[model samples]
Target chain A: MIWKYICGSASSPLSVSFSERPRDGQVIFNSGVYLIGVKSGLLALSARCPHLGCQLAYNAADRRFQCPCHGSQFSLKGHRLKGPAKKEMTVLELRQDHECEGYKVIF
Target chain B: MQQTADYGQQTTDNNHGQRTTDNGPRTNYGQLALWAFHVALLTGVILSFHYRPWGDVFKSVSKISGWLPYGDFLRKLHYLAGQCFLILSFAHVLEHFLKETYRRIRPKEWSRLVLLFSLGFPLLFTGFILKGDKEGILAGEVMYHLAQEIPLIGSGLARMLLRPGEEFFLLPYLYHTVILPLTVIFLLDRHTRRLLPRGDWGWPFMAFLALLATFFPLPPDIPPYMEISHISGPWFFHGVQLLLRQVPPLWAGVIWPVIPLLLTALLPFAPPKLSKWGKRLTMAAWLIHGMILVAAWL
Candidate 1:
């Protein structure tokens, strides 16, 4: 019971526009979320690292998200590149909103 | 007959009623560590008066450094004294390992000393978290998730140590100021048969720290959003920090730290061969950890 309370995510769904997305290979942080513009598409990732939840910092030069605490690295597409983290970065569900020309990110 | 109590020399009555010299426990790093603990406790108490745990803890700490009279000096002194206490305590344990003092001491007392040594981690770490700086906050978060990596009870334990979705400093402040110090004091008295060190071994250490505080004020706290590529935890955590890069958190955070404590616990009761193996493993672990620490720094 208490575990559920402690582990539960606090963020709600966020709607971000296509224009607001970062350029290719770049990442923009908006309200605890990382919106990365990868070569394929926009990837919305939770800023918290899966390993120890230390905030991940995007290295534009290296084009990888690095965990400052434990050195877990993820690709621009949110794939696990190097780890202590056994899992890839948590990608929120993105639904296209034709009306707003944007996507609804379910955190 | 009259005798002098000096170093390891002590006079004891032989079976024939003649006085004979016996080697007692000598003054060692343990005593010096205790003295450092005393200084740390004193300065911690004084510094607590100026520290505000509620609302904008970073700014509150900044005020202690920038606004209050001699607050910066006192804070630095407290930080240095705490570090010395931890380092000297480890050195004392190392000296014991080298001397095989555990063999001579009663198993119960040795076990108590082991517990005392283990307590140093939380005592020091909670204080580090209470600083409310970027490194400290991230370190606390790391600890939380590390604790959460345990199988069944992880979440409960993590929540107990650090309240999730809550202001960070309150619980850590309580642990740092009250619970840990009292536990340390009790264990120190039980293990050493005295709470305070004899003579003034601590004064020189304190003097050195005072001089250091005068010259080297702690670096200003940086905000979390800064483009700092690497955030290091406390110096003692470097090895684990590096290890976490290579292994899973369950191994790096939980199992690795517990291995030494388990070995220390088993040493007194294990068979001679097992004890020898335990000692060897402990030494190897420290060596690897030292190398890893160096690697993390580089």
Candidate 2:
């Protein structure tokens, strides 16, 4: 299946290298997508906070997503840390494209 | 037996005299207010049949005013009745204030009256803006920006109060035609009952309003194409506009307008020992308001 290109390779700050520790990256393509680089691979999550559907902003200091409308906090991996929001953030699938030298996010 | 019969007759006469003294003669003002309220409401309902709040309100208003048989008359009646209601209500408030009616007996009643009175101006402002003329649109923009200037949650509050984009006209229209009238009616019912147990002069008052509406029909002002800078709001809001020109939006628009209203609302709840001071304070506040109004006019 052909994967759609979402963000440029430089957009995701996380390296595809297996040895590197996981870090959070925010890519603004459609709505908002957050890329989480982990030991296993790269994970993409929707930036919309589940609680009130407000766009979530990535908090670099806390390494989590925080909602602006209501204070709902989610961990880098989309786990609900604190919420008026009951559920976790929606995760998206992303694939690496060698031709574009960038990660293509699958909707 | 003859003496006993005379005494019983005298007692019955005294009771009848006492009842007459307690009821007092009917005043024209309250009746006038009642009639005006009804006339305004009726004409407003009639006007609403053709008036659309959105998409060229000025044109819609003009169509109703210039075209349709008796449409101009109905619109005039509505406008005149609203003015009459405001005038009568202000007179009533002043009468109560001078009489110190709220302090000795029903403070809460006084507060309710103040609340109703305070609400009237905003209702009027909203009504003017519903015209959707250039001046009216300008007023809306002024209000939106003023609301946006409020500290802390100003932007959010503004967003909640005003609709975004071209549909901005809807909120004020809803407020003017529906929300405000309903609220005023609810408050007026209570206020009227507190003042008079029975309103017996409805028919005559209605007749009087009809006569007034016929003789002095309200003429619609031409809607301006471009925003005229000199254009002020309705006379009642002239003071606020003047104040806004001088002071910061936060002070003139929000705080200054709010303080007097707050004081008026809390007047009835003032401590008994400070009741005298409260009355003085209230009077002072109103006097300041009067001065501002005069200055605004000048």
* lDDT against the true structure, each candidate: 0.74, 0.65
Candidate closest to the true structure, highest DockQ: 1
lDDT digits (tens) for residues A9-80 of candidate 1: 344122223456567877887545687777888777887888888888889889888988878899877889
Residue A24, candidate 2: how far off, in angstroms? 52
Give the lowest summed-lDDT range of ten residues in model 1 chain B.
B1-10
User: What tens-digit string does per-residue lDDT give for candidate 1 at B1-298?
Assistant: 3322222334453232333233344655677778778878998898889888777788888888889899889888888877877887777677667666566555665677778778888888888888888787888899888989899999999887887454577878888999899999988766655676765556776688789989985856776556567888888888888888888789988998777776775567767768778788877877877787898788
Candidate 1 has a TM-score of 0.83
Q: C-alpha displacement of B1 in model 1, angstroms?
A: 20
Best by lDDT: 1
Model 2, runs deviating above 4 Å: A1-107, B1-28, B193-208, B215-224, B227-229
Instruction: Give the TM-score (0 to 1) of chain B in model 1.
Output: 0.89
Which digits, one per residue and each the tens of the lDDT, describe model 2 over residues B55-93? 778898888878968887787778777877777666656
